[model samples]
Target: MTLRAGVLGLGVMGRHHSRVLNELEGVEFKGVYDPSDAVPSHIEGKPVVRDLDTFLDMGFDYCVVAAPTIYHLEIGTMLASRGIHALIEKPVASTSEAANELRDLFTAAGLVGGVGHIERYNPALQSARQRIQDGLLGDIYQVTTRRQGPFPGRIADVGVIKDLATHDIDLTAWVTQQEYVSINARTTFRSGREHEDMVLAIGTLSKGTIVSHTVNWLTPFKERTTIITGEHGSLVADTLTADLTYFENGVRHHQWDDISQFRGVSEGDVTRFALDKKEPLRAEHEAFRDAVLSGDTSAIVTLAQGAAVVATAEKFVADGLEHRLTTP
Candidate 1:
């Protein structure tokens, strides 16, 4: 069965979603909905509807909400009311409250609502998750992520945490199969924007694994890395290149007494696994499409999971605000 799909935004992500939808198997790219006159009238031979009602009337089995973060709640409400499935972008809504509202709305409507946490579909991260679950990483101890990059002018409604760090927040919990129990953070707004441009967050998961996230938009280069250290070794996943490497703990004993006493775990062999390296966005769309068709949300990131990530991000922001230090 070919499912009809539409995009609700024409921004960077929206355009990419449209392209993937148009190319995806068993899916039909209907068109796009963007009230902004700035966007072109047509993309890839598909009409870009200027009116929301007219766009909704086009009849889509699922709609990808790539609109600005501020408009997620409003757009999600409309889709839910129309009994349409939706795959909203990350940081599900502008606020945790709005995210929860959308979650409940979709749940009540019995619609297949998902969040575009594309990192979950990264080949490296996907491999890491499977390996960790298979006990390749015995007894997870810590998870650390660093996501920094030059700010893109395309994102104006939210800051680095919401725009970038949400990827780490969601992927960490997902790869570890755990939930965040507590989090503390500190933020800085060096970019002169109302929202923060940098944040350092530390949290603990339900399984007692510690996690730290360093995210910012002031870097000169783009880096997406997640390192999960367990009793056996560490799995380092570089999402930017879809590379996963494992650093195993050395079994060789140190000869020197002093060196052996100080060294906790000796450096072992490092192996980078080969991955399929499929485009994460395409994989994400495929998962959502499968969920919509099968009526099983297991393979997709549900709205509830997205809401939890937003709630955790809200706590991080609040903690940062409360603990902000002043310099003299």
Candidate 2:
């Protein structure tokens, strides 16, 4: 059965969602709902709807809520009321309360709802998660992520923690199958924006695994890297290039007296696995589509998970604010 799908935004991510929905298998691209005068009247040869009610009447089995963070709760509530499934973008809502409401609404309505945490679909991360699960990384110790890039002018509603660090929060928990237990963070408003432009967060997970995230909008170049260090070795995943490298812990004893005095483990062989680098966006769409088709949600990030990430981000912001720093 071919399911009908529509998109709710026409911004950068929304445009890409429209294009992918138009080409996705077993899915019929219905159109889009973006009242912005700036958005064109058509996208992917489909009409760009101007009215919310009119767009709802188009009969979509599922809708992609690619609208800004502010509109997620409204759009999701409307979709749930209409008995339509929804795939809301990450950070599920502007606030944890809003996200929980959306989650409860969809759950009560018995509709398929997922959050768009696209990093979970990245091939390198996916491979890393699998390997870690398979005991390749025995006794996971730490997860460190660095996601830095120049600020995108399109974002204005949220700060770096919510905008970028949410990716690390969700991905770290997912890769290790653990939830954050506590977090402390520091933030700076270097860009003169209402929201912070840079953040450094460190937290412990439910399994006692420590994690740290370094995210900012002031970097000169873009970097999307996650390093998972465990008992046996470390797995480095570069999501930017979809590469996964494994550094095995050295088992041989050092010959030099100075080298042998090192307390920590030494590096052994390094192997970069060949991965099928599929477009993460397309993979995400496929996972959501499959979830909508079947009654299974294991493949997609649930709204609850997304809401938890938002809560963690809020904690980071609050912690940063509580411990204000002054320099002489």
Candidate 3:
């Protein structure tokens, strides 16, 4: 049962999706649709359609909507109307309201829909989730994430929050299995664009876990890291390097066992787990493909989660704007 797969864009992420679909088993890379006037020479081998109608008529069982964030709703609507399942990129839509519409449309059509929160498929993150579930991290106290890098020429429609930090927001909730209760955020527009280029946010999870995120497009070096601290130890994952490490807490053997004596801090051992590293995007594509084929969406990011992440990001932007207006 080969699934006919199509891609909606040919940008950075879309190009990767096209290549992966071409190589992915059980999926035929039918073609791609881009609104741009000229298709890049790099994409010469695959079929390219500039017309939306013709692209929709390609008989795609599923399509990857890797287009810009603003076009998500329109593309998703078209796909859903045609009974084509879609895997939309993260921050599913430009706004939460639009995300809800896409979600409902897909749900009403009985289509297999998923958001491309690729971090959920990172080998390190996957291992961390399993270990946390196994009670290795104990009661999670806080989760901090940092995703920073220079501005990519491909991004134009969204800021750092939507383009990058949404990954951390969704990841914190997924890894902790908790809902965000509240959030406080501040943003900066260093690039003079309509949207923010950097953001610092602190969020509270339902279980009293504090999640902090520092995401920006101004950093000279790229870093994608997550730290989970709990009662027993801490789990750290580096998404770019695919490294999962655990730092243990040490207990000092005190000779002065007095009632009022305090034990000094002890540096513990660090352990790095060996993981079978693979491209997270490929894993995400596989998950979406399998869900479309099996009618199971337990492992993929649901539309509701996508909307929730967007709602959270909206709060961040709103708060940032309010703060700017209130400042002297």
Candidate 4:
């Protein structure tokens, strides 16, 4: 049976998802929903339902909710209550309490719930994680991520930490397999919005690994990079370029007792891996569809995990608030 799927909110990102869902196998793009002034010309010309209740009434087996942040809890809770599978956008909600409520709602309904953590499906990230897990990055010491770009819109309601840094937060946790025990964050706002335009955060894991993240929407160019420093070497991953560079240079035992016998560090081999094919979004859509069909949630990041990412981000935001001495 063809899996009937509908996408909610066909804005910029939702439109991209609309295109990929159609191309993916075993997915029948039943319709799309967006209250915007315009709608896409494709998707078998299904109705762009203007009513939430009526839209949910239609025979959509599952949903891909790319709606705005505020509407996430409302629409997601509604669909999840109806036992419909959902893949909501990141930051799950504005707060951890709300995020967990949605997770519990889905769990209670026995429905599959996932998030659009598109970065998790990146081939480069996947490869890097595999290497790290394979002991390539023996005893990781620190991980740093940088995501900067020219300001994007609709981010006034949310800060750079939630809008941009959340990706790295989730990525760092996944790659390093650690939970943030503590976080210290600072923010700067130039857009005059309640949200911060630039944010820097540092998190320490129980494993003694330190992770620092830099997120800014006011940069001159677009950059998506993650650097992981392990005991043996360091890895530089560029999502935009689809490349991973590994550097092996670190301190070693020196025969200094032999009077000026410090051996110079050897600039170890640098290897760059190419992501041959497969768009991450398309892969993510396919994974979601298959997981739904198989009734397994292994491949896709579970709603609970996604909520945890939001939880950490929430902590960062809260830390920022505390730093400014506001009762957030």
Candidate 5:
């Protein structure tokens, strides 16, 4: 069965989504919508609809809301009201309150609402998550993430925490199967904008794992990396290159007295796992398509999870310390 999909907001991310949808096997790229004249008359050989209602009237199985963060709540609510499934961009909405409203709208409509937390589809991250769950990284002690890149001039409403760090916030909790128990964060406004350009955050998870994230828009170059440390060793994943490397701990053999003086810590061996790489955006869209067809939301990022991430991101923006109990 072929599902027809529409792209909303023909911005940088929106164009990518439209291109991928056209390339996907079981999905048809119907068209796109943008208020401004930024989009060409034809995108990837398809017409660009300037009228949003006309685009919706084209009969879409789902729509990808890649519009600015400020418009997420409005577009998402429109989609939900039309009984159309939607795959909204990361951060879900501009703020926590709006995110909750979208979540409620989707839930009440019984639609397959998904967020574009595309990192969930990264092959390297997926492999790392599997290894951790399989006890390769026994008893995770700490997880550190670094996501830095130049300032995207397209963004005017949100700061680094909401734009970049939210990915790590969602991925960290999802990979560890834990809930954030407490969070502490600080922000720096190097750009003199109303929003922050850099953020440093530390959070504790339900399972006693410590997570730290450094995200900013001031970097000269881009980097997407994650490091997971455990008693046995550490696992490093570079999402940019789709590589997962493990550094094992060396065996310790010494006299009984030596145990007190020397800690048995040495880099044993370096191993990088081979992965069949695919574009994370394509995988994310495919997952959303499948969820709409299968009636199973098990694999996609649920609305509630997206809302939780937004709530956490808001906490980071507030530069406050918070302690919350895990809910069953």
Candidate 6:
């Protein structure tokens, strides 16, 4: 059975979804819908509805709501009401309450809903998490992430937290299986926009492990990197390159009475990892389709998970603002 998928909002990311839908085998690109179809036509045979109701009424098995953050609650509510499975973009809604309300609706509908935290699908991350689980890294300590780039003028709809940093926020916690105990952040605005263009956040996981995240819309060059430090070794990831570098450099402390003249030395090896041959977006969409077909929540980005990420981002923003007020 083919999974009929429709996408809302034909913007940058939405258009990417459309492209994947067209290329993905065993999936039907039912239609594409945006308020204005004035742009150069992309879909050939598929219908481009003037309104969303027609697309929803088409009885799509699953929908990808790539609309802006503010429209998430409204679009998700409508889809859930129709018993449609939807993969909404991250930071599920503009506010925590809104996220909760939509989550409730989905739970009541008993639908296989998901959030578009696409970074989780990255193959480097897939490999990293596998290594972590295999005890290769062994007891992770400090984790740092940097996702910075030129201002995404296209996404002025929300602050840096929801727009750019949400990916790192969710994936870090998910990979570690830890809850964010606290977040400290600092935000900056340069272009006189309502949202901050630069944000820096620090958080501690439940097991006393610490994580630091830095995201900005204004930078000299584009960058997406993650560094994980553990007891045995460390792993570095370049999301853009989809490359991984494992560093075995670590220090092992000895008891004060153990060494008489000097301590022994250890050398670490450098290992590089290669990513699989599929694009993350394609992998993510296919997972959504499979989840819809099987009603499996395992591959789905559960609403509670979305809420936790949003809550963490909100905390970062709050702390950032407070820090600005207190600092010189």
lDDT of each: 0.94, 0.95, 0.91, 0.83, 0.90, 0.83
lDDT of 3 by residue, 1-328 (tens): 9999999998888888998999999998988899787656346378778888988887989999999999999899999999999999988999999999999999999999999999999999999999999999799999999999999987889888998999999999999999999999998988989899999999899999999999999999999999999887899999999999999888777666683286343568899999999899899988899999999999899998999999999998888777764336
For model 1, how does the per-residue alpha-carbon lDDT over 198-296 read when each residue is reduced to its tens digit? 999999999999999999999999999999999999999999999999999988777999877874777899998999988999999989999999999
- Give Cα distance to truth, residue 54, candidate 3, Å: 0.8
Relative to the true structure, candidate 2 has a C-alpha RMSD (angstroms) of 1.7
The candidate with the higher TM-score, 3 or 4, is 3
What's the distance in Å from true for residue 271, model 2? 0.2
Q: Compared to the true structure, candidate 6 yields what TM-score? A: 0.93
**Candidate 2 colliding pairs, count:** 0
**Winner on TM-score (2 vs 4):** 2
Give the C-alpha lDDT of model 4: 0.83
lDDT of 6 by residue, 275-318 (tens): 68468898898888888888887876788789877887888888
Least accurate 10 contiguous residues by lDDT in model 5:
318-327
Off by over 4 Å in 1: 254-263
TM-score of each: 0.97, 0.97, 0.96, 0.93, 0.95, 0.93
- Candidate 5 per-residue lDDT, tens place, 4-55, comes to 8988988899899989999988888999999888569889899898888888
Clashing pairs in 2: none
Q: What is the lDDT of residue 210 in candidate 3?
A: 95
Which candidate would rank higher by TM-score, 4 or 5? 5
Tens-place lDDT digits, model 2, residues 1-328: 9999999999999999999999999999989999999999999999999999999998999999999899999999999999999999887999999999998999999999999999999999999999999999899999999999999999989999999999999999999999999999999988988898999899999999999999999999999999999999999999999999999998878799998887688779999999999999999999999998897999999988889999999999999988867678
Q: Per-residue lDDT for 188-216 in model 4, tens only?
A: 76777888888889989879999888889
